[model samples]
Target chain A: MILDLHNHSIKSDDGRARVESYCQWIRKKEIPIDGFVLTEHRQYDDESDYRALEDEFGLRILKGSEVETEYGHVLVFGVNDDLRAAFDFTRIDLPLATVLEESGRCGAQAVPCHPGRPNVGLCAHYETRGVPEGVEIIEVASGGSRAGEDEAAAALAERHDYAGVGGSDAHIVSHIGRCATRFPREIRDEEDLVAALREGGFEAVRWT
Target chain B: MMVEFGDEFEFQPDVSMPTVKSFTTEATRMDFWRFTDHEKARELGGLPGAIVPGIMSQGILAAAIHRFLPGSTIRKIDTIFRAPLLVDSSPTARGVVTHVDEEEGTAEIDLTLVNEAGETPVLGTAVVEVARAE
Candidate 1:
């Protein structure tokens, strides 16, 4: 199963494209992406919209949020409504380690998003200091704008002994499937997908 | 008052025109990253010398907006990277106020970050909240 595990939609502050628009672009490009995770930033408003797209497009869609942690940005996948409701998006006082621990306990994978960006958020220091136990993937691609950063991220993943994952980190429709990761096993659900990633059953691939 | 759509802005380089060699030298001197080598900058998708940070480009856009539409606080910015900006490149940041909602006290500006080579390194729009002057 190929999955673009990190991405954004109109739900994010920086995103300007709809979920359906991105799905359509994937189909048009003939990219062999089997699933996509809508990891919108700090907002869970797009869950219904993403579900609708999944039903219409027949693709495995995962719902998650990329929260801005004190150390940097972290992806919290597999977060159910109850858990999301309990968490506060504006709280940035928690240490990186505490955030990772909570995310792990919640059964959500705490993958850091775009650690190489110069100054916006997370960097190598946090990644090295507070990496969670099931932290399996490092984002190696984003919207074709930061190929150099992607390469650096890939190197970091290799250095840290983590699996490499790529995503467009796209906020616009044209960028959805620009990058993805192909898994070695068939993932039937969110649990299986997370397991596949944890077991190192994936390879990063770019669409174009 | 807002600057109407289609307004133009320009920023001239310290020197008249730039050659590839000068561009490379200027890009190498930028302190955004620890490395100062042209090849390293190139490897980082920066033009073959000292490339400006994308945030710097955004800063230039912020300056342009402040110049035309004073008292505007940048609420959101979305930028798309198109090409590498060579060092010493004479790039101009331009913007136009596209939409305004009177009740929300917000305006949207279409912005572009372009260089002398006629290449657009980053293009996107920003949403700003304009505060009325006291």
Candidate 2:
């Protein structure tokens, strides 16, 4: 199954379209995908309305968030109420290890989003603190960043042997699916995606 | 000329808590985006100390543009985050006019948010309407 593991909805400060808007566009364009993850920036609150749209489109809808940690923006998938209680995500100064530890406790997979996107990226910061453990994947490609940056990140991921992923990082309707990940198995929910992330059965691909 | 290519208008933004508190996001209060605490900001960006938000710097630049070309509309702002603007030392936002079209009545401006140490934290370009004749 194909999933654009990253993108933002109207829930994000810079994003324009709502979660449903993304689902509608996918249906209209007949994009070959089973689902996509909505990774809102610095926030985590998924409404039930999104699930209904998931049913309507016959596609799985997963919840994720692009958290602005002290180091950089980190993409966290499989968030749960228990995990939220353990960590304060609203603050932008969360330490990198804290986030990963919490995600681990909640069975979530935390990947640094766009590790090469300038100041907000974790790639340079990694030079200071180095890559932490439990980080099995990294976003080597992002539609929202520079092309050279994405290529450089892809090379870094290759060198580190970290499973690479890609996303459109879309803040609007037109910005969807410039990059995506193809999973080897079908995913019906967030649990499956999390498992897929850990087991390593995905490949990052770019269309635009 | 008053409006030469390298001509610039500069101002120091008020970083006081009360003043910054008055500035809110387009959507919600979002105070965390504005509040300045050196230790926290340093922890956030791994910088030297307390630094202002890049968005807030952009906001100050937008305000400067509106003040310069009164009653004019700002069309676009292309900002590239260069460094973190330290908060303890006063930071200045400058708008340098690059090109002006007499007939079009539009101005192309380059902006820099620089700290007291002359470090430019944010560099951006703006397209704005200079003015129109009656």
Winner by DockQ: 1
Q: Identify the candidate with maximal lDDT.
A: 2
The C-alpha local distance difference test score for the whole of candidate 2 amounts to 0.74
For model 1, the docking class works out as incorrect
Candidate 1 local accuracy as lDDT? 0.65
Off by over 4 Å in 1: A92-94, A121-135, A144-147, B1-121, B125-134
TM-score of candidate 2 chain A against the true chain A: 0.93
Clashing pairs in 2: B38-B50
Task: Please report how far candidate 2 places residue A14 from its true position, in Å.
Answer: 1.5
- Candidate 1 residue-wise lDDT at A7: 82
Query: Candidate 1 lDDT, tens digit per residue, A109-147?
Result: 667777676443355455555644445566665544343
